[model samples]
Target: MYYEDPILKLEDFSLNIGNTKILKNLDLDIYPGEIILLYGPRNSGKSSLLRSFVHLNEELYNNVEGVGGIYFLGKSVFDLDRKYLRSQITYSDPTFVENLNFLTLKEILNLSLGLKLKDISKEYFSILEKLGISKIFSDLDNLKEYNSLKNWSIGEKISLITFISLARRPKVFIFDSILDHLDDFLLEDVKDILYRIKEDRTLIISTRNFSLFSDIAERVVFLDDGKISFAGKTESFIINYPK
Candidate 1:
């Protein structure tokens, strides 16, 4: 059997926030084409671990004291540029979507890709169609006239952000508590979209709603009080950590 190199590695990683130990000695190996479901209760350091990757060059990491480090593709995240690292490892938080209601869907996607809307290729349209949001794009002009996204439900906003993030086709997609806000129908759609796209990228979803994504997750990592309690195949995880 042949094993590919891990796309991301957290070696003895630890995090401290205001004298409280958030993540303690976390060592994880994430490979390409893997959908990892991070399961934990609130304040278990799921969001903190995910945010650390996004703010590799920010004060977030600088302020926190830790000996271990995160490595992307065998390179230390600390050595990479913030923008460059984010482009490869995109992070999305559903709560931030509503704040961006002023921007149209096209504008959001364009800004994510760093290109004008006109320059967007057929691939973008294909992704929208796959995610069942092509109609949203088709009616962009009419929708813009009314500032329609403002009226969208929380689920819709979450899905829109997920779609926009997917449009960028990042090497690693980090989703923080995105599934919790989604309804059953929308959740299934998003799961299907993740399955379709997981072949070419790594997906790290920090969600409390773990059972909903059990079928789609190749591996499950259970975090308890900032420590990884279990990390294994989905079936094994379910068997070991029975509800």
Candidate 2:
């Protein structure tokens, strides 16, 4: 489902940190609902580029050169309200953690929707059931609200973090190697959610594991040493890789 109009565009984008040139003259045009895979070895600037979009590193953000423009739904990312714009674009990673220990998954999700509890009981349970988290987290009735984030297991912590991002209904989701720890069943479930979301949103993921999503992604962009070496259909990546 390629958008005739691109939702995100970066032209001649470049970034530098502490006198090191990270990204050099990068250009990318992506449409909504299209799956873009960034395949590269370690330290190839894949994660750095993703972070630039979300404005995570202030050093990179301040020292960035060129346009480095990002358009979300035809509006400049810098033009949108910080909070509202952030909700439209979520940057996720399996190891990505800020804080989620004090609250349960339910509380975090509610917070994403303005922290309102009204008219949420039904929708909340329905999502939990679909994500296969109802059992472990238990039903909402048995759960207690959290006041802080601390002592969350790896799986529980990641799942809840992802749930918060999804609840925002972002139009574009950028993930950095999120499938690192997912098992087969859980991977498929996450894929199902992405596919459902792809019906209306664009998903960009960076991964070194190609086998995990062979038939799921539409296109793969190979990056090496901060440069785009190849861009083509997902099925053609291996065949195109130098032997």
Candidate 3:
């Protein structure tokens, strides 16, 4: 008999921000091509743990301390280059846009790839078509937006952020659903996109809504007060989900 190794592994992992303890000695193994629905209440360290995977928390927070090992493909996360690791294990948070030149529809969409819109516009729209938001623009000229995000709908921003993250072509995708304002249709589109790609990549979606993306989550890991209260198959998760 043979067994496969987990793509990502957390061994007795813990995190601290300033004087606050965020994650408490977490241990889990994430296999490749797995769709993991990571959920918890607000400030339960979902974002902190996700950021830790790419080591984003250390750069943004001055008083951050993390212990234990976070490994990707048997390599210590600390041993890898931050930029390269980030590109490979992308963490997409809708509200936290890094180095934003201008939060235009075009620029936001092109945030990850950094290629001219003309070159990838055809490929871009095809991806958007799957998410049902492709009808907003017919050509590259329609990509400009001067008002940051004030003029655009919340749904549009969410969709574009989701798409931008996917364009990175990462091995592991960690998405933070910041703007929970998207309608049902958009959520379905996002779910479809995730399901379509899960065969080749690993996905971890952090959401407050239990019902959101439940259909695609093969496994559910629940975090409570920075501790994993439940980690099991989605079917058993329903029976064993912490109250």
Residue-wise C-alpha lDDT for candidate 3, range 122-218, written one tens digit per residue: 6677887866667666554455442255565666666766777788889998887653557887777778878888987999988888777677999
Which is superior by lDDT, 1 or 2?
A: 1
Better of 1 and 2 by TM-score: 1
TM-score of 2: 0.83
- Writing each residue's lDDT as its tens digit, candidate 2 over 1-243 gives 453888887777777776788877787888877888888888898998887676665633565543466666677766777667667789877545555554544566566666543345656656656666655445344344332345455655556556666777788888788765666776777778877779678888888777776567888888888888877887687677852
The per-model lDDT (C-alpha) reads 0.80, 0.70, 0.79
Candidate rank order under lDDT:
1, 3, 2
Q: Which lDDT tens digits does candidate 1 get at residues 28-61?
A: 9999999999999888989888888866323544
Q: TM-score of predicted model 1?
A: 0.89
How does each model score on TM-score?
Answer: 0.89, 0.83, 0.89
- Full-model lDDT, candidate 1: 0.80
Off by over 4 Å in 3: 97-101, 109-111, 144-150
How high is the lDDT of residue 205 in model 3?
85
C-alpha lDDT (0 to 100) for residue 199 of candidate 1: 86
What's the CA error at residue 6 for candidate 2, in Å?
Answer: 0.5
